[model samples]
Target: MVVLNWNGADDTIRCLHSLDAAALETPFRVLVVDNGSSDGSVGRIRREHPDAEILELPSNLGYGGGNNAGFRRAEEMGADEVLFLNNDTVVDSGFALPLLTVLRGEGGAGAVVPKIFYMANPSLIWYAGGEVSLRSGLVRHVGLRRHDGPRFSRPGTTGYATGCCVGLRVGVVRALGGFDEAFGMYAEDVDLSLRLRAMGLRIVFVPSSMVWHRVSGAFEGRLLRKLWLRTASTVRLLQKHGTPFSVPLFLLLLPLRLVPAAAGMFFSRLRREESV
Candidate 1:
């Protein structure tokens, strides 16, 4: 597994610890990519987990580039599969085998993702499966905030899987050239999913496999910044893989997402001015 870190040393350390300590059915090694963290994350991670292989970047490479860097390394190392996990996640000990089994068994599956729950509220679901609409080409996360139950009992294929904890078929991904760096930090997973599907690969969601995440930990309080990145990435995705109406649909829906964020920014500025 490869965990990407950017200044979240504590979270990354904890994640490494989980992997080191988890009881997996098969042998595994971890590769940590310190995405140019200014917080001394590289030094700290080296000290904490001397066993993990470290890849130190000179500067931030966004999510796509950082993971691609790791993917390339994994490819060179002759890995059959690679898991891309966010540093903010604390994975379940037995999560690996089930996902790996599906990836190996399903010849058409390019990637598989585990069920995720919010770490703060363990019973609440973060992801189950995802859908990409054929008409609008819009992607939606299934069962985002719902509580865990038997309703989501079965495994299913999805159009996209969050990069938070995805197990990838390394050879196929490397041959396809991995993620498009044009996506940067957001929607890169969706772009990868689309490209894999174009190549006749399936994206699977395994309900039996689970991971806990501190949702969007890096951009937690920077809502507007995250919004803008997402907006830009969404447009890039549409342009790259648009149906006849995809661009038009995205354009029409853009403001519905952005206007609210702009209003929030406007009000925040107004409140500051009033205080002054």
Candidate 2:
């Protein structure tokens, strides 16, 4: 398992503790890649989880670079597969085995993703699966903010696998050159999934495996920055993988989406300030 840490020692440590307590038949090692955190994250994680291997980078390399570093290390360590998990998630005790079962089973599967729910409200889904529309340049979660039901219980292939808690076949990912680092943070998973699909491999979703994510934990107080990164990454994604109409459609719809969202945020902030 690889967990990327960037000044989030508390969340990272909690995730590590959950992994430690998980019941899995397969032996796995935790590799915490510290993305040049200056918050003493390295020392704290090292002290708390002495057994986990720590890979310290020189600076913040964003999500792709950091996880790519972890992938390389896992390859060197002779790992056949790797689980790229967010530092702000808590896994179910039986999560790993289900994903592994799917990944190691028959057919050509590049990756397997676990069912993800909101940490604040465990019954609400964050990402049951994923969908990508190249024509519209829209990538969305299958069951965003919805209650988990029989609809999400079936195991099958999906358009994409989220990086939040996806288990990948290391050899195949290495062959595809890992994630496109061009995506600093957002949409890299979508890019990777498209690549996998192009290679005739399936991105499987295993509902039995589950985890809870503290959604947007890393961008809690940075709404504008998050929006900017997401928007820029979306543009890049469309440029790289979209159909002819994708970019134009995205551009046409961009202002329509952003204007209302930005207005709501501004008004919400003004209201908070006035209340204060």
Candidate 3:
């Protein structure tokens, strides 16, 4: 398990405690990447789980940066695979083994993500990998809210998976160089997914592997903040893939992007029974 930590001392402690109890079929090491946290988290973990490995950075490298550091350590350890779990997550006891089982057989499956449930609301599905419609330029969940029936219960390839709790092959990640640090935070996963797809690799959703995540805890619950980062990252991603004519293409698509967000706001207010 590779976790990135800031000042989340309490959550970090809890995550580690859960990992200690999660019985695995194979031996797996836990590496905590401390992104220059001043909460004395390193000291706390050392005092608590002395056997666990810890990597400390000089400053906060954001999510992509922190995870990249952990990925490097995992690579150096010669690990066959690396699983990235959020500091605010509790991995299910059967998580790692099931993922490993699927990974060993699935060709083109460079990365695999488990079914994530809201730590606060375990019944709700946080994400189910879906199709990215190029025509609409929107991403949708294949089995978001419907249920965990035959549709969602099966493991298959997806356009992308949440970075919250993903298991990746070490070689694939090393070749790709972990998450794109240029993204800093938001949409780094999206950028990573696109790159993997470009390489003819697949990102899969494995339902048997599960984890409970505290949604948006690291970024806090700031809509504007999420929007700003997401929009900016999307722009950067498009820009990189977009050629010199990218400007004209973005111009053509800018309205398409705004319309949905605007409509979403209107419906959100309507659902709350607030006057527009």
Candidate 4:
């Protein structure tokens, strides 16, 4: 497991504890990468989990760059499959086996995302594997913020899978050259999944494996804040892929991406009962 840490010591420790508890039989070593946290997170980790390998970076590289650093190290260490998990998530009980089973057994599956839910309320869905909008050039996580039900059992291909708690085969990671650091953070997962799909590989969601995530992790508040960053990432995506073949399609469907943010903003206001 490669977990990126940036002043999230408490959450990272809790997440590691959850993984240790859930993975009693799985046999995994954790590599915790600290992206120049001034909060003494590295000291805390060394004190609490002395067994974990600590990689201390000199500067605060963004999410994509930080994780890419860890990924490269893991690959160098001969890791067969790397689990890229957010520091703010806790692994569901006995989740690793199911995820490994799916990744190892499923033919043509290059990457897989676990069923994710809000950490505080596991009953609410965070995201299930699904497609990104080709027309609007938006990435949609299937069943996000919905209650999970029988519909989750149907496994299928999505245009992309989320980076939060997703597993990727080492071969595919090497093939696609890991994640694009240009993403900085947002939409890196979508870009990776899309690239894998374009290479004729499958990116899937396995319902049986689960993880609890803190939605947005560090960024929590107005929906526009989230949307603006994602929009910037989307623009980066277009720069990488949009062209004569994709420009027309993305132009026609791009507006649909805004709907989710608008709806999210409305709900956020309702929850707070006040507009800022």
Candidate 5:
């Protein structure tokens, strides 16, 4: 398993603890890639989780670079598969086995993702499966904010596998050259999923494997920055995979989509300031 950390020591340490607690019948190792965190995250994580293998990068390499580093390290360590997990998530004890089983049994599967729930409200789903529309340049998570139920329990092939907690076949991903670092952070997962699909590999969703994510924990209190990165990455995604009309359509609908989100953030900040 690979968990990328970027100046978020507390969350990373908690994630490590959860991994230590996970019930996996197969042997595995945890690789924590520190993305040049300036907050002394390396020292803290090393001190807290002595058994985890730590790969320290010189500077913040964003999401793709950091995970790419971890992928390489995992490859070097002779791992057949790699699970890229977010630093702000807690996994269910049985999460690992289901994803591994599906990845191994499904010969066409390039990647598999576990069902994700909001850590703040564990019953609320964050991502069950994902869909990417090249026609509209939109990436939608199936069952977002919905209550977990039988409808989401079925394991099947999906359009995309979210980076939050996706298990990947190392050989397949390495041959595809890993994630496009040009994406930096946002939409990189979508780009990877698209590439995997283009290669005739299925992106499977295994609901039996589950995780609880502190949604957007990396961008907490930084709404504008998050919005900017997401917007830029979305445009880049459209350019790479969308039809010519898709980019134009996305830009045309930008204001319709962005304005309300920006307004909500603005009001939210004002309300917080007033409360202070």
Candidate 6:
């Protein structure tokens, strides 16, 4: 498991503890990569979980760089599959086995994501995989903010599996050159899954394997910043995959990509006005 930490010591520590206490029987090692944090996150993780390997980077590599570093190290260490998980998440009681089971059983599956819910309220979903419309540049989280239900109980193919808690077959990922670090952070998972799909591989969502995410724990309330980063990543996706019309498609879909965030801000303003 690779947990990327950027000045998020508390959440990283909690995530480490949760993984250490997981019910899965697989022998594994956690690699906590400190993306040039000044908050002493590396020291804390080392002191708290001496068993985990600490990779202290000299500068912030962003999410893609950090995880790719971990992935390369994991490959060298003979890891058949690598789990790229966020430091602000808690693995469900026995998360690994279910994910592995699906990845192995599904004939063409190259990766899988666990069902994710909000850490603040475990009953509410944060992600359950997502559906993306490349034509419209619209992506929507499956069951976003929705309560858990029977509707999400089965394993299924997803447009993309989130990076927050996803497992990938190392050999395949490495062959494809790992994740495109240009993504920096946002939308990297989507880009990876799209590549796998284009290559005729599957990305599965395993609901039985669950995780809870502290949504935006490390960078809360920075909507505008995240929006631009994600937008830039999506644009790159078009340039990389949308052949014959990449530039024009990017221009056409740019504003559509911001719709959800814009709608969110619009409603937030209305609520404040009503309360006033």
The collision pairs in model 1 are: none
Cα RMSD (angstroms) for every candidate in the order listed: 5.0, 3.6, 4.6, 3.2, 3.0, 3.7
| Candidate 2 lDDT over residue span 1-276, tens digit each | 999999999999999988987845445888999999999999999899887899999999999999999999999998999999999999988889989988998988889999998777779788988988888767778987689999998999999989898898888888889989988989999999899899999999999999998777787567798779888898899999887889999878887788765664455345434543
For residues 1-276, write the lDDT of model 1, one tens digit per residue. 889999999999988777865645556778888888898998898899877799999999989889999998887788999999999999888888888899999468889999998776678787898887645646667876678888765787886989899998888887779878877778888888888888898899999998988776786457678777877777778778877788778778776757765664455344334543
The parts of candidate 5 lying over 4 Å away from their true place are: 23-26, 259-276
Model 2: ten consecutive residues of lowest lDDT: 267-276
2 versus 3: better TM-score goes to = 2
For all candidates in order, the CA lDDT equals: 0.82, 0.88, 0.76, 0.80, 0.88, 0.81
Clashes of each: 0, 0, 0, 3, 0, 0
| TM-score, one value per model | 0.90, 0.92, 0.84, 0.89, 0.93, 0.89
Q: 1 or 2: which has the higher TM-score?
A: 2
Which 10-residue window of candidate 1 scores lowest in summed lDDT? 267-276
- Expressed as tens digits, the lDDT of each residue in 165-258 for candidate 6 is 8898887888778888887768888888888888899898989898988777655556677677777777777667666566577668677657
- In the range 186-225, model 5's lDDT, one tens digit per residue, is 9999999998898999999999998998777787689879
lDDT of model 1 at residue 187? 83
- Overlapping backbone residue pairs in candidate 5 total 0
Q: List the residue pairs that clash in candidate 5.
A: none
Candidate 4 lDDT over 211-253, as tens digits, reads: 8886665765656687777777887787677654455566566
Candidate 3 overall Cα lDDT vs. reference?
0.76
Model 5: lDDT of residue 241: 90
After superposition, candidate 2 runs with Cα above 4 Å error: 23-26, 256-276
Give the least accurate 10-residue stretch of model 6, judged by summed lDDT.
Answer: 267-276
Evaluate model 3: give its TM-score: 0.84
Query: Looking at candidate 4, what is the lDDT of residue 161?
Result: 80
